[model samples]
Target: MDQPTRQRRGLLIVLSSPSGAGKSTIARMLLESDKDVTMSVSATTRPKRPGEVDDLDYHFVDDAGFDAMIDEGDFVEWAPVFGYRYGTPKAPVKDALREGRDILFDIDWQGTQQLEAAMGEDLVSIFILPPSMNELEHRLRSRGTDSDEVIADRMSRAASEISHWPEYEYVLVNRDMDQCVAQVRAIVAAERLKRTRRIGLVTFVRDLIGPAH
Candidate 1:
């Protein structure tokens, strides 16, 4: 007989890293390889740009609409950036969680902290690090897009970001891109199998054992 499928609650996967640490590359690889995982679409007050679709590209709203959401406690985390407000809406996240669909967040430590506070049990936080400071600088320089001044600024900020590594549930050193991505995938797999996240396990085990007197 075919075994019954085990339902599980979805995961909120957060990936954080300093510039040149390969976090974005790892996130893109995971999304491309795993159909079940989707990127978190943030709601923003910024005006829609050319060719952007509503609710797909972003849940674009005006200042009053955004404020209403904030007043109604609709956002998990919100912040002002360059005169525009951006936030992760609670409704879609709750819906995804109930439907057992994973959401990926590419956010910084502060945002991760807010998410952890709001959804700690369902959240899996990972911090990616460069193999070394020298290697990080080399990677930045090799990009060939940034000026020497910009590279120095990034290197300075990288130190501050790396200091928050201890706050994450898992820390990975991006010595090789493929290895780092594999490690992240492994982490997601293990987290999905956690007993707390797997729903209906008690009944499944009980059925296997049969009814007791």
Candidate 2:
């Protein structure tokens, strides 16, 4: 006989890496390919960039609004970043998880630490690493998006970000995009099967096995 369907609680999937390490690219690929996983839109005081949609790209709010949410305990975790404040709202994430829809977070190591403290076992964290420092600098320059000074600043910050690799449960060296994405997908698949995540497994198995006879 076929097994009964077991219910599962959704996972909070987090991916962290320094700029130009292809973290954002991997995240985009995952969101595009996986129907069950969705990005966790954060609330931020920063102005929306070109082509960024409100609530989709980010829930852009003002300083006053951000402070009000902070005061009301609306955020799971929040921190000042670059001259602005950014945070993941508590309600939507919890709702999604209860509905068995996985949520993806693309945040820095500091934010990852905060989320780990707040969400604990619900979170699965991964860190992406550049193949080498030279390759990292090359990728940053190849973008042609920033001036030399900005690139230098990013390189300096990359060292600090990479130092937190030990904090993640999984680490991937992004030498090739396709392979890196495959590895991440495999991790997500395996994590979904973890015994703790499947809430209804005991009943499903008991039904399959029959009552002690």
Candidate 3:
């Protein structure tokens, strides 16, 4: 069987938030629902969590390996957060974009900045915040992955992260998980309909005009 032609003109979605602000959850759902979209796997210096496979949850690498890629200009964006380094590779994302498949990023604000600088107009940025500070604290504590001290530190850092909401094109209050996911899906749908991303649509329009009489 012949393979289908790759898509053209994809979206670059930047979904950013504090450690426990639900950006990751929404990103996962978006990926699940949309065949045209996929996550931009990040390269991290941190060790893989249990059952985490490379190139899935993250691409775990050694310092020297990551640094070598950095020196080679292999990352579209990179940042050092909480003692661990993380970066978005330059190639896969670009290739996905060229093939007309949208890529979602679950990075923090700093990484989003680098992506914006790199992808420019191709980027669609969103910031997610908890319903309130109390709720955020609660969510962080409930995760059970980090200790009290770590959770406290994360909550403290969250304030700074949430302050950057105005910078995002879309701000979502993750009060209700399903609703927020729907809202995000709607945004993606609208973005996909954007004229600039529809090269074929331009040709379709010209055809509609019937050779300019």
Candidate 4:
């Protein structure tokens, strides 16, 4: 008979980049193509934007609700961004890792630090960089989603975010979208094969070698 499939622990994959550096695009492509991974929906105290579905986009909650969750120690990591609070609920992340299902996080450096402190070896972080600062500014303008003032603010924030690139396990220069996505996928594939993640590897290898006789 064929042997049962070996179980493995999941990864907490973090993708962080400066605004308009293509991490969001890469993340969407990955989620569409990768079946073993899923996005981690965060709980936020901010109001949902138009067409944003609750629990799908974000679990919107009031300040009081967020405070309650904090008091109960329900979050694995939480942070404040733009005067709003966002947190990764502890229960779902814990469950996913135990089930050998990966979770993706699209957050900034501060949030990544919190997760790294909480998850250590279970986390694999990637920082995406723009080819050039000029090119980064160009992409922000091309999006047409923000005013010049807002774009300038984002550019300043981008510099700060890029300074933290050394914190990640992998760094990719996103000169080409398709190539970057491919490289990130390769990272995921390799990380999944890590000995620590493969919880059943020892037994599987033992079975292959046959009982010590």
Model 1 weakest lDDT span, ten residues long: 1-10
Model 1, 1-213: lDDT tens digits are: 213335899999999999888888899999999999999988999989899999987899999999999999999988765468888999989999999999999877877888999999999999999999999999999989999998998898889889999999999999999999899999999999898988867667778778791
Report, for every candidate in turn, its global Cα lDDT versus the true structure.
0.90, 0.92, 0.87, 0.92
- List candidate 3 stretches off by more than 4 Å: 1-8
TM-score of each prediction: 0.86, 0.95, 0.93, 0.95
Show model 2 residue runs off by greater than 4 Å: 1-4
lDDT of 3 by residue, 91-164 (tens): 99889888888999888889988898989788999899888889888888888888999988998899898888
* Clash pairs (backbone) in predicted model 1: none
- Quote model 3's TM-score: 0.93
* CA shift of 174, model 2, Å: 0.2
Q: What lDDT score is found at residue 126 in candidate 2? A: 98
RMSD of each: 2.7, 1.5, 3.0, 1.5
Error of 2 at 151 (Å): 1.0
Question: For model 2, how does the per-residue alpha-carbon lDDT over 1-213 read when each residue is reduced to its tens digit?
Answer: 434344688999999999999999999999998998999999999999999999999999999999999999999888877678899999998998898889999988878998999888999999999999999999999999999999999999999999999999999999999999999999999988888888887778788778794
